[model samples]
Target: MIKDIIANTTNIKLTVIIRRALQGVASNNNPYLTLILQDNTGIINARLWDVSATDIEALVAGQVVTISANSLLYNNELQLKINDYQVLSGKEAEKHYQNLVISAPINVEKEWKDLLKTVEDFDDAILKKVVLHLLKQNEKDFTTRPAAVRMHHNVRSGLLWHTATMLKTAKEIVKVYHDREINQDLLYAGVIMHDFGKIWELSSQLITNFTLQGNMQGHIVLGSEQIGLACRTLKINEQEPIILLLQHLVLASHGKYEFGSPVLPKVLEAEILHQLDNLDAKITIIDDALKPLNSGMATNRLLALEGRIFYKHEGEKKKK
Candidate 1:
């Protein structure tokens, strides 16, 4: 049985397939493969011990190979010292290596249906029509697109999943700011189409890689272009289309220049979209990082979701 390196202790033999091999230096002189081994539950880092030229030649990234290693904690993080390793060549590799990734735990179809219900709750016809068109245009891709290349919700059906969450939050905010003339239509449009560019930005597999277009134009540019084209095809009113398109711009840009936005959010709706998106992304990072920790104990450290460290919620511990 495959065991997670995270829970493995000394002398515990684990049968895990090496998933990724990252090169790094050890002890300032030795080269090592900082590997990531995965099973069904989770992935953890492992250190390939006693690296030699011959050993390095036998393994390659993405190959399913058996590893014998001893687990140890370094700086409060779990890691394994690989003792012996070999690539499972041919059929064995094919049987163990899974390239396609679609999370089965989450009920994507049910979640999408519920999301549509939330969209239907909106009384505005124009906003609904715009959303319907965008969704229809990219329905196939959206259903299977990962939200990002490696960050939050990077799984099949992730684009829809993230969009649905953002929409639900935006709905609550709309009710609060209804009288402010915040343009609910634009707000909803922004929420639905904000990250649609991600469909092209990332590879749609268990291991996502950046595409040429993704590297050349990035999501913000690609997403904006897509919205522009959809707007023209629908022949939406010029002013309304501009506002709707700006909604996606706000989401794509997030806030500052460093965060990959060409321009910062200037409008009230745009500012709100940035804040909501930031909040959701940060929370997701913290939540996913802390999943391996025991219920009551605090985690050692978080690698900062958006360049900032996060402390676990104290309230969750009390309740537990």
Candidate 2:
């Protein structure tokens, strides 16, 4: 696994998928291949020195290869010094595909089943129908796609893990505000639908890049449009109360206009959805940052957290 690469590990043999491949030139105009390799656990960077343009273009993303390398740790970055590598293809690549794909640790089937059931149990009939219809329509991608290209939940099945966790958090929050008459159905539907368009926004599991439509319109716009499409398909008016509210939640869930929300959240449920969504994504960012650090060591600045660094303590408290 890429995660197991460390300073003292002198030499290793591994099979991984090429997540990215690019050619760069040095001052002398020597061509080198810059490669981002990925496996189930994590990813690592590597350099293929003295490579031709042909080598760089031929090694496209999503190609599986086995490498023989000596670990080189330089300036706090670990890179593979490739002594040799062989591209695996046909049946051989298929054999390693399952192990190389990064995935959320959650049980995919159970989480997916429960997520569907949550929608099915919604007391609001209109909300229930729209959410279930859209979710089932995109079940294949929603169940397996990554939530992002590189942020929190950037692994296969990460979309489910992030959404499921947010759903659970929203459920508990609804109970806490029991007397407030908060719309649990709307909040829950918002959580699920907020990022559902990512199924089309991001590339397939092997290489998680933004599609042209994603780069142009983004998930928020795409999701809101998806809701509008669903309403039309079900013969529900786009201006119907529930349809409008759901679309609004999807639109304003990013919270601020600066963050790409065209309008601020006017509804309480939309605001709550924004908070919970940000909370989950930020929590995952922190957890992922702390992973490779030792006690008393601080992480490098994280752009995801506005360039703040985090420290890992010696030990964590046990759950009772």
TM-score of each: 0.82, 0.93
Write out the backbone clash pairs for model 1: none
TM-score of 1: 0.82
Where does candidate 2 have its weakest 10-residue lDDT segment?
311-320
RMSD of 2: 2.0
Query: Each model's C-alpha lDDT?
Result: 0.68, 0.88
Q: Write down the RMSD of all candidates, one decimal each.
A: 3.5, 2.0
The TM-score of candidate 2 is 0.93
Tens digits of per-residue lDDT for model 1 on 1-320? 33344545655455455556677777768888787766555667888855777767765555566777777777656677888776677886676555323342457787667756655666776666656776767777887777875567766677877877887898899888768868676676677767878878886655667788999988777777776676678887636855455644544457878878887886777777788888877777777666655555555555554355444554665433
Q: Give per-residue CA lDDT, model 2, range 1-320, as digits (tens).
A: 78888764656898999988877897788888889998888888888888876677667898999988878766556788777788889999999999889889899999999999999999998899889999999899999899998888999899999999999999999999898868999999999999988987998857889999999999999999999999899988889898899999999999999999987899999999999999999999988877765678777788989998888887854337
Q: Where's the lowest-lDDT run of ten residues in candidate 1?
A: 96-105
Off by over 4 Å in 1: 1-8, 11-19, 53-58, 89-91, 97-105, 117-127, 235-252, 295-297, 300-320
Q: Report residue 232 deviation for candidate 1 (angstroms).
A: 3.9
